[model samples]
Target: MNGIEHYRRAEELMEQATATRTNKSGFEVCYVTNEEQERLTRLANVHALLALSAAQADATEFKRELYRANGEELPAAQSAKERAEAKTARNAALAAAFID
Candidate 1:
């Protein structure tokens, strides 16, 4: 699926995960366990990263085209490797948050 579709799916999952109930004493309770919630969040983050990657690629190409058309220099930005490393670090943090 496209990045935006992935992102939308992640949002839907997050909404589903937030579903809660009132306990006997009226305290709010999440339907899913903490581990399950963490897993969902991790998945959502991955989807978000995918969307970012797609959007960045689109933006880079658009900028390149615009610069070429105008005979101007393109602006500097993070390389794909740097972006991938950042995404990896984010994913690692998400995974670590749920570790025992």
Candidate 2:
């Protein structure tokens, strides 16, 4: 799912969170609906980014770490352009997840 950028999906979650969050737990619970599925996908994407940030390890090791961290392992893809795109997408997702 490397090429499957979930950035906009994440933003959609933020919007939902903003719209539906009426209490302390509302925001947290809003992430589970089918309407917020993209947000969950984007969260997984950002968590994967944390694992992918390791520079010294090979792809398999990265995959292992992500799984160990309970995140999904994105498929093996070798291309600078793709990586750049993924990074951008992940950043957008992170902003959506963290920035509100």
- Clashes in model 2: which pairs? none
Q: Each prediction's TM-score against the native?
A: 0.58, 0.25
Candidate topping lDDT: 1
After superposition, which runs of candidate 1 have C-alpha atoms over 4 Å from their true positions?
24-27, 71-100
Prediction 1 global C-alpha lDDT: 0.86
Model 1 lDDT tens row, 1-100: 7768988988977876777899999999889988888888888888888888888988988989999999998867899999999999999999999794
Total clashes, candidate 1?
A: 0
Cα RMSD to native, each candidate? 15.6, 20.2
The residue-level lDDT of candidate 2 at 12 comes to: 49
The CA lDDT of each predicted structure is: 0.86, 0.60
